[model samples]
Target chain A: MADFEPTIVAFCCHYCAYGAADLAGSMRLEYPTNIRVIRLPCTGKITPVFLLRAFEKGADGVYVAGCLEGDCHFIQGNLVAKPRVNYTKKLIQEVGLEPERLEMFNMSAAMGPRFAEVAREFTERIKNLGPSPLNKKNRNKTDKAA
Target chain B: MVIGERKPFDEIMRMAEGLKKIMVLGCGGCVTVCLTGGHDEVRVLSSQLRMARDKAGNPIEIIEKTIERQCDPEYVDQVESIVPEVDAVFSMACGAGVQFMAEKYTGKPVYPSLNTTFVGGSKKEGYYVERCQTCGECKLYYTGGICPIARCSKSLLNGPCGGSTKGKCEIDPDVDCAWQLIIDRLKSLGMMDRYEDIMPANDWRTNRDGGPRKMIREDFQR
Candidate 1:
């Protein structure tokens, strides 16, 4: 488990989490390279299919990072995505995977350090769980893309 | 609308043990409206099944296609060209759709992905409740549009049946007493006289007791 470098997918809202990641880079914040960020217009657009497909595609961990509560770019995109995240967690559990493999986090666009912190934290969580049973034959392919 | 809920993934996987290739047929009817077996659901369920099969060292190739309505032969025929390519069919529609698929392709094994729940609709976004029993009888004019047959626990004709309390059914506190609703509705409409008339016994012959029934439109057929 210590040597396992998990392929963690972070689905981020453009107005907040994605901007936070950019800020994190500008700040030169050091986070694990294992985390891959997928920028979305809003977390509310995140569907159960997207989360499930991530697991089916062999993601060790998947998390949706959106705007802080009541601070959404589109009024209540974060709140809209909350129940969907919870619903997808149950779905992944149905497939014999740990529900902890998927998570949702909220942060403002200004929180660069929090973005990097979340990256490291989720990576550590996935590392503890080891590689997903459905891990691709060539796991390192995603390493370069991120 | 016919409400359908997907069966457990394990049960579906168990039935899919020997399948190599399949077509996930989705219905664009009641199941779609109910948010169960639609286009997106076919993909989701197919993806899940593919992953589970892959993990178990048995890979399955899935061809996904959703039709207008699985209950109609016109739509079911749309899959004719591709259906022959797959060994079996994994239907994501209701039991009727699944059975229709089975009947159409007697050679291929057809599997149902959902358990057909009831004839119902939802006032709530995600919660659906039954509203009809299809008893081949119409009595809504007298019951103030509230159906005691489907809503009542006992399906009594002269209900309230000494079990209703606090305007709720004795079976479940959450269930509203159908007869109580009828009484209240009739009273509000100044038509309490409708309830005063003693109801006669229902003819079981008109119900499913008469066996499988059909409607023939002689003009349309000709």
Candidate 2:
């Protein structure tokens, strides 16, 4: 349990978070290796189904990172995503998972340091929470079947 | 269009507890437009069920299908061959669609995955509000298109009832008084004079009180 490695899925908008990640790499800012980022055209493209799918597929934590409020390239994409992400958080909590396991963040394209900071913060949060209960249950079932 | 919402995940899981295989049927009609039951919804629900079942050591198989409209016999018949292949059907359509499927195929267990909520329209993207009660008779012409039967907390016709205040209903401050909206619309349309005409009590026979109603068109009958 002390050395458990959690798998975190981050949906990043192309215009901001994705670019920030690239900038973070160029700047050699260190972030968690456990985070797997999926780039989307915009944060508005992030749906509740996508977030749920990540957990179903054994992700310990999931987050959507988009442009800062009122700064979406699509004008209101991040604004639309804000409520959807909050709704997904409530939904996951209802399904027995901790609402903290899912989150939403906003950052500008040039915020490489901020991107890395978020990655570290989110990774630490998930690490303290440990692996998702859904993942643990699946592992136990597989072990029993074997 | 009729609006519906998905049933709680726990209830759905309980219904499929003993089943090894099931078909999740999605409706492409009102349910699709409302974002509850549709092709994408069927896929999402199927995946979730599969994951939950897998974690329970039961590993159930889910078949996902969406028909044009579940209330129509033609669309319901299209899934005949697939129906027999699964142990049960989890219908994501409205109540009418679920009953239609059950009536078409007897003996097989059909469970509703959604609770049929209301006859409503989208107030905006992703927001829906009840607008009609399907009372066989429509009085929209007299009420400036606002439906008292559906919007009024007490379903009070000819009212800005004693409970109305500041254009809001007493039932909930957030809800607007239907009669207030009707009056406002009438005032804007210069039809305020019509408001003076008293409305008679609604005919209960034209509503569900008449018991399972149906409309038959003699001209379209084959």
Candidate 3:
């Protein structure tokens, strides 16, 4: 378990979080390598199903990063995402997983440092929670076969 | 226009106990219009149930399908081939759809995922309030188009009960005094004279107080 490498998924909005990731790359900011970013047009495109699907498919931790509050490029897209993320938290808890495994964050496109910091913070959080039970179960099955 | 809401998550899991593979059937009718049970909802519920089962280490195989309308036999017939594959049918439709699916497949178990609520229209998105009880009789002409049988807590046809207070029912502050709404509507329509006529006692024989009711269109029948 000490050697476990958590697989994280970050649903980044193209206008902000994705651009921030691009800037993070340009600035050469160091963030954890656990994140696998899936760029979305806007966080408003997110539904509870998408987050639920991530955990079902074995993502150890998932976070949606959109534009800061009222600064959404498409007006209130970021505002629309907060509740869906919160609702998905309850859903994961219902599935017997920690609600902390999923989250939502907001930042402008220029906040590359914040993006890196968020990635590192979320990665560290998931690492402490350990591998998701779904993934762990798969590992156990593989070990049994071996 | 029947309204419904999903049963609690815990109740759903409890009802699904010991069931392995089951079909989650959704109706694209009233339940769908109300955002209760529809194609999107079926997927959401199926996904949730699968994750819950997986987390419990008791994984379940769920088949998801949404029919045009489960109340009709032709639509229910669409699942005849797939029905045999699952242990039971989890209907996300209202009670009628659930019973129809159950009746169509006598060998398989059928369960309702939504509590069949009332016949009503949405006040807005995701908000539903009962408007009719389908008491087999309607007196909207005298009641100013409001249904006392449904809107009134006591289903009082004559007027507001003693419990009415300042336009709200005593049952809850949120519940509007149905009779008050009726009286105001009547006054606005210049139909205040109708309010003076005391409504006669309703006939129980026309409602559920009678036995289960059925109607047949003789001309449409073979």
Show model 3 residue runs off by greater than 4 Å. Answer: A135-146
Candidate order, lDDT descending: 3, 2, 1
Q: Estimate TM-scores for all models.
A: 0.95, 0.90, 0.93
Q: What is the DockQ of each candidate?
A: 0.42, 0.29, 0.39
Across residues B47-72, which tens digit of lDDT does each residue of candidate 3 receive?
Answer: 77877777777877888899999999
Best by DockQ: 1
Model 2 chain B TM at 0.98
Worst 10 residues of 1 chain A by lDDT: A137-146
By lDDT, the better pick of 1 and 3 is 3
> In model 1, which regions exceed 4 Å deviation?
A135-146
Cα lDDT computed for each candidate against the true fold: 0.87, 0.89, 0.89
Tens digit per residue, CA lDDT, model 3, A23-88: 999999999999999999999999887887777777899999999898898899988899889988
Quote the positional error of residue B157 for candidate 2 in Å. Answer: 3.8
B81-127 per-residue lDDT for model 2 (tens digits): 99999999999999999999999999799999999999999989779
The true-versus-predicted C-alpha distance at residue A14 of model 3, in Å, is 1.7
Q: List the residue pairs that clash in candidate 1.
A: none
lDDT score of residue B94 within candidate 2: 98
Q: Report the Cα lDDT for residue B38, model 3.
A: 95
Q: State the lDDT of candidate 2 residue by residue for A18-96, as single tens digits.
A: 9999999999999999899999999999887788778877789999999999899999999989898998887676566
